[model samples]
Target: MTNFPNPDENHASARAGWEHIFRGGDIPPRYRSLAEPNPQVVEWADTLPAGGLLLDVGCGVGRHVVYLGGRGFRIAGIDISPTGIRMSQEISAQRQIPFEGHVSPMTALPWPAITFDGALSTSAIHHQRRADLVQALAEVWRVLKPGAVFIADFPSTDTLDYQDMRTRVAAGQLTEVEPNTFVDESTSPDPMEDLFLPHHYCDAADLRDLLRHFEIVRLQADLRPVTTAQGSGKVGKWVVWARRPMTT
Candidate 1:
């Protein structure tokens, strides 16, 4: 918290740092499984049709971007961190994955309506607050074509494992630098550190409520077992699946 920007500015820095870490392969061990396809990824991979636009939100290090691009889907990604975007770009180049990465927030994507055929976001939504979440969902709606698939997974209030991380960090044990704080407004950028939004943790029921805008094709909670690295607790991880409705 030293030499930190304003809360708003600090927030942006937090995001930027994550982007840098994502590219640098410095992702906290708790979140560094870019290779292992999570359950949400499994569902997304199964639903993705061949040769269509796939938007990879929060594309850390471009792992999925490279994979999906190789699968014949045109790809693009958005992330709050510049380092992440840069890393994705480098990885894309090194692996010959044809895709673009935008260093910006998903709430204000630089794309037009019906821009994608399929979309995926795994283990990265809790970084947004409720308002940001709604904005992000709206952006998804705006960019996704009718009947296109959209998948996302995030933390819920029931996700006490993350809470343990914070407690342990305070006690000087966990490797995580800090517990991302939820705030009223977005944070600003700091050259040294990044800011993030651990804004909302919607339970299954709560997610259902916010997902009213979408068709909500399906929903899953606590599907994966929480590892000791993630947290030593009974609460498991959560994920959700949804679809944009076809226009009548």
Candidate 2:
């Protein structure tokens, strides 16, 4: 059997990042977006049969989970952060919403094959290295029933922030160990310990190649507003909605 890294081991940085942001409480207003679900997800959900099961991969704080659950869909959410899962559970309970929350990496989901009718991964998958990102996408594909739809948003290489990062790499401020991969360091006011995490940026062509197995429904350029930490202007992302073919 292949040994998958436990959340505390290989995924420590991701878990720590989210735990620090959430701090075991209500999700910050900027991150809490239950009132407005992703438009693509909303459109796909409308077409699902009654009582469809939807999986929210990298579901931080259960924002989408709660919203979809309240809409009568059976919801299941998974995230690498224990704190995130806890917060999601607490909020769901407080809101009287029913859903399953699991603390696990997207690369290795703790579920059987073809378990969900739909899946949504927003602003999440890009956190991993390319290998892990591929594994996560394959896992997502594996868990969805044939003809099911999946929507995801990933950072694009065309973003201004990415260009700036490249310039910094040239100046040796940050390191790029692999193509389109960066070893991110905290640029905080005070000195901080390094997480040694790998962040990957993808272009539209890369995504098309990676997801060649699925029929592409729509792929559009999305601009994500960044906080001061991420620098000025909006970074780019590719939001894709695709469906698995009914037959292999």
Candidate 3:
């Protein structure tokens, strides 16, 4: 998510960082698995009626798009990288999966209101600044049909790694330009370059505020082990599955 170039010039540094990261041709193994829909995502999507329109926000290289579109879902994907969008389009064509891919920022999605029956913003969202995150979530809420489902994940502040990061920031070992937001720099000898990108980690209160427009069905922390260039440890991730209230 941090890899997305911010539309505003104030985030020029962040944009440069992201552009450099995406310039690499190597596709991480973790992302390769995304070429197929996650079982959890499939389970959630199955609940929707047939012919539902689904969106893949921050869809890098169109993995989810190919998987979901091949299954007959009318799929659309958006990403900040032109290469990602191009790759996505190429993959969709190769797989013969009908899809539309756009190069756009998640904060400013180019879609009409109530346009999607379901949406998935996976492994994204955390890259945004506070205001951008707010805008992105609002856009998600706006584009989703009433009673539609949306699932997303972001980093969580309720973790040891978060505390460690904060401690480093407190000691001036790293920079926190915005509250709970980190900029590019790491204490690790060989930090995961991407980890240094701008990231906003949130707490439960933050999640509640972000999801206020929707009826939250599930909100939980995913404690998964991850290693940065600095060290190896577990970081908590926040997963939210929610629905737009029918009355709204």
Candidate 4:
């Protein structure tokens, strides 16, 4: 059996680490590249009703909020890091893109039930442990209207980082909090790579199990080459397009 950190401790640690990273304002170049809207998200969102209200879960720095808002969507974003929310608001202001932003965790969205017409998350929900991920998805479900379109991405276990972390955990160099969940303890001169937090990886089976409540429209790997200041490699992500059921 694998040992896991106390749930409360794990959550607190992740929140603090992200807060520190965002507060430093030295975001890595790789992350900076993410300021642009994801093409897949844009394509999926194009199907949404024009000018409909949308919610962005874990909207780090509001990349999607700003981009989608500019495209004429009424968008709001939420993140656990106050600095992230503040920076997103500042950027939106600078660009004159009107959007709402709030500081909160994905597991506990501040919005009322069925308040959004559509919702999305990118590269964010996988930051939690399995249980927390479930709660966060439930919160997303709670806020979305019946039959609302929802899309999100999860880190794939096939990624090089996941393989490296598996090797490290086997060598006892890193702790495996759960089956595919790990506490990132590796050090890096690059502040971007220095994030110390829990990273959860998933596969197709995991996604199917986790999203059983939704009507899955698409489930496929989002493969792309990524170059960072430290090195270059490919990242494999499981991008899922799902819809909230029309009832219950």
> Judged by TM-score, which candidate is best?
4
Candidate 2 lDDT tens digits, 1-248: 96554544548777776666556333344444456777767777788878899999989878788878888999899998787788789888988878799999898899999999999998677777677788888998899999999999877787886787698789877778567877656454112322245567788888898788888888888887665765666777788998888987
Lowest lDDT 10-mer window, candidate 2? 188-197
Q: Can you write out model 3's per-residue Cα lDDT over 1-248, one digit (the tens) per residue? A: 56653457534544454455455534244443445566568778778778789999888767688778877899998888776777788888888888888878887788999999999987767786788888888999999999999998878886766877788788877688778987646444223336556678988898999889999998978787777876777776888898999986
Q: Between prediction 1 and prediction 2, which has the larger TM-score? A: 2
Instruction: Find the candidate with the highest lDDT and give its number.
Output: 4
What C-alpha lDDT, on a 0 to 100 scale, does residue 226 get in candidate 3?
Answer: 73
Name the lDDT of candidate 3. Answer: 0.77
RMSD of 1: 6.1
RMSD of each: 6.1, 4.7, 4.7, 3.4
Clashes of 1: 14
TM-score for all models, in order of appearance: 0.75, 0.83, 0.84, 0.87
Native-referenced Cα lDDT, model 4:
0.81
The clash numbers for all candidates, in the given order, read: 14, 0, 3, 0
Local accuracy of candidate 4 as per-residue lDDT tens digits, 101-181 = 998878889989988989999878888788889889989988999999889988888777777788878886777877798
